[model samples]
Target: MNDEINYTNNPLHGLGLQELLTQIVDHYGFEILYAYLNINCFKTNPSIESSVKFLKKTEWAREKVEIFYLYQYKNLPRVSSEQFELPPRKRIIPEGQTPREPAELSFEDAERVREKQAKKAAEHGKSKRYKEREFENLWKR
Candidate 1:
């Protein structure tokens, strides 16, 4: 079976690093980028060429810029504390849409939700403890 990854929903797919830098620079300009990223490329004699060079060499700085693009510029829905953390590829894209407000829950529904969360937490703790034990056993061998 042939499987292909579809990037239709991904905002960062077609865009190159240079293009990303240029778009961000066009939208926010170098001074604002400098304020947000606080990188030397944006602060000192800033240019698209220089910033791209810096971002290419620095992984952390590149991630920051990409995150800024996703959250600030693209305005994707903010991740909720309760939801499982997802990587960029796994996250749902909002495509310029406003985030929907969470629905109000009744007392019973709220209690149920809390119980569910506690159960999930307990399960996660068990798995973590099991992994630690496994690692300890491996070291003893």
Candidate 2:
């Protein structure tokens, strides 16, 4: 039994159109690639298929695509062995820093607010009675 060449488990293998576009973008500026590819996707939201179609048909566009592929491979960001972690920073306060004073509502003010709320509720009840009169007429109809 012969083991066939696996396309899946390979470096820089099975590169999809979107991935190819993204990699090319990361390496070369969008404007340069747009000029090179002459594809609408590169210029004004041209799709991968449209770009691929243009490139496949035109040799110049195909050359640009090859150049982009090479650029992407060369300038790929190296995977760092060292993991990046944010340093545990201690928030420092000045030596003479004072805490804010606690806010407390006075009993007289509280009572006044309660009385105002009761007055609003009574007003609301009066308005509600008028609305109920309309509903009673509707029910009769």
Candidate 3:
């Protein structure tokens, strides 16, 4: 008797890439997607066909879109650290966790997120430089 539980509960299961992109684009529009994802394909002369082609050629970008689709479009709860490391499509949804309504997203919110990320990156760069300088001083002493 097979005791293994089927873990194909992921919303991405059996979904095609083009279909996924189409759904998100139809709902969110390219501007919002570009704002949130920062993908050039969405920002420059955006269309479903061209974006799909670019995503197909780019693995990392495709994964980014997949993650966006799950957590943003589907509004699924964040996964655990172990599952978080897996690709969004490969991750399993825990039992009893059904997708909720799509989160309300706006270009303004995306702008805020981008600004916060930029600020954090700047701070991180400063701290790294400070630490390197400190290490060099230790060697000099």
Candidate 4:
């Protein structure tokens, strides 16, 4: 009979809103925890201690806190992996157009590409693009 109200055999034994909020804040900083929860407690001008008091009175806030705890901390059933995996779709390449396979880049080819990129970056850096732009602005002043 007691099982009807609570989770498992102990419905009356769940942690309240304050407890859940405290745990979340302890794990993640107050700012981040508040951002994710999006409750008035964290958003209010007062600090976490004060916010806890305000949150305790609000039934809706308490419910959300409890739900998040139950879902994440309490090991609730997860959605099936199948939900994330996309179904296979047909690839349609035009018959007349040849689909070019990617060029097999050897180790030498990769090293050459890297060296070229490094040289390009060095040239760009030496150009002092920022200094050029700042000089124009400074002269305009």
Candidate 5:
């Protein structure tokens, strides 16, 4: 049985960089994008043309924007890690899964997300140090 996943259903499949950027900018604006994405292109002198040009030249940033477009703007369900390895344009949406309404986002919500991420990172760092100290103590005994 053939198990090929059809990617044509993805909204990003044939969408141009300019068009994608324009849609998000129209809905969310550059300020909200910068707050959530932290991309300099969106933050500094942001414009649809400038952002599209920058994203065209930059692979990582383009991928980031595409991902934000899929997960946040299109409100698609999160993909499995294997599927996520593919670009958002190529990732396969499971059968019966369709895009939903764009998420309601705000600058304040972005700030809260950043704070939560920072807290998680600090906790991870503390645990790593504790583990290292424990390892050293085990060797010294």
Candidate 6:
């Protein structure tokens, strides 16, 4: 007997990025997407192709779109009152509903999150260096 992991509870499993974008575009036009996400792809001459290409290349933007889908489109229940949150895989899905698969963020989203963290870390390093320089300058004076 083969044991297969059932992901029926997940709301983002089987859906592809293209389909997700299409559904979103259909439900809410580019204008609304632009207003909501503030992505340039939606703002300036938006098209599925262009948006998909941009999303594929840019991780942060893709994560934003995925987050929007999880919150606005899927309508999943909120986790708790905690300020910090768990990743989607750890969160429990509501029972009795056939959740859309692919709940986990896409590869692009994950990469984007990493890139964002790296950028923040770089900025923090810069700040630290600046502070150290200022301290050294004070000593020199």
The candidate that wins on TM-score is 3
Q: For model 3, how does the per-residue alpha-carbon lDDT over 47-94 read when each residue is reduced to its tens digit?
A: 999998999998878887887888788888767767766766778889
**TM-score ranking, best first:** 3, 5, 6, 1, 4, 2
Query: What ranking emerges by lDDT with the best candidate at the front?
Result: 3, 5, 6, 1, 4, 2
Provide the overall lDDT of each model, using Cα atoms, as 2-decimal numbers.
0.57, 0.41, 0.76, 0.42, 0.75, 0.58
- Model 3 TM-score? 0.81
Model 2: per-residue Cα lDDT over 14-116, one tens digit each: 5554576666565554665554334465787666667666655765455445433432333222221231111101111123333222222244543554455
Model 1 off-target regions past 4 Å? 1-6, 80-141
Which is the better candidate, 1 or 4, if ranked by TM-score? 1
Query: Mind giving the per-residue lDDT tens digits that candidate 4 earns over 1-141?
Result: 532332332211454545666665665555553543456667666365676687668655654454344333332332223411211111121223331222232345435544554565566674544333222222111
* lDDT per residue as tens, model 1, 1-141: 111143445566677889888877877778766654557898899999988888889776776676566655665555443311443334445445442332222445435544554566566665643433322222121
User: Model 4 — which ten-residue stretch has the worst lDDT?
Assistant: 84-93
Best by lDDT: 3
Better of 4 and 6 by TM-score: 6
Model 5 residue runs over 4 Å out of place are 1-5, 122-141
Give the better candidate number (2 or 5) by lDDT: 5
Residue 6 error, candidate 1, Å: 5.5
Off by over 4 Å in 6: 1-8, 80-92, 97-141
- Among residues 3 or more apart in sequence or in different chains, the pairs in candidate 2 whose N, CA or C atoms overlap within 3 Å are 40-46, 41-46
Worst 10 residues of 2 by lDDT: 83-92
Clashes, model 6 = 8
Q: Which scores better on lDDT, 3 or 5?
A: 3
Task: Tell me the lDDT of model 6 at 137.
Answer: 24
Per-residue lDDT of 141 in model 1? 13
TM-score for each predicted model, relative to the true structure = 0.56, 0.31, 0.81, 0.42, 0.79, 0.56
**Model 1 C-alpha lDDT versus the unseen true structure:** 0.57
Error of 6 at 26 (Å): 0.3
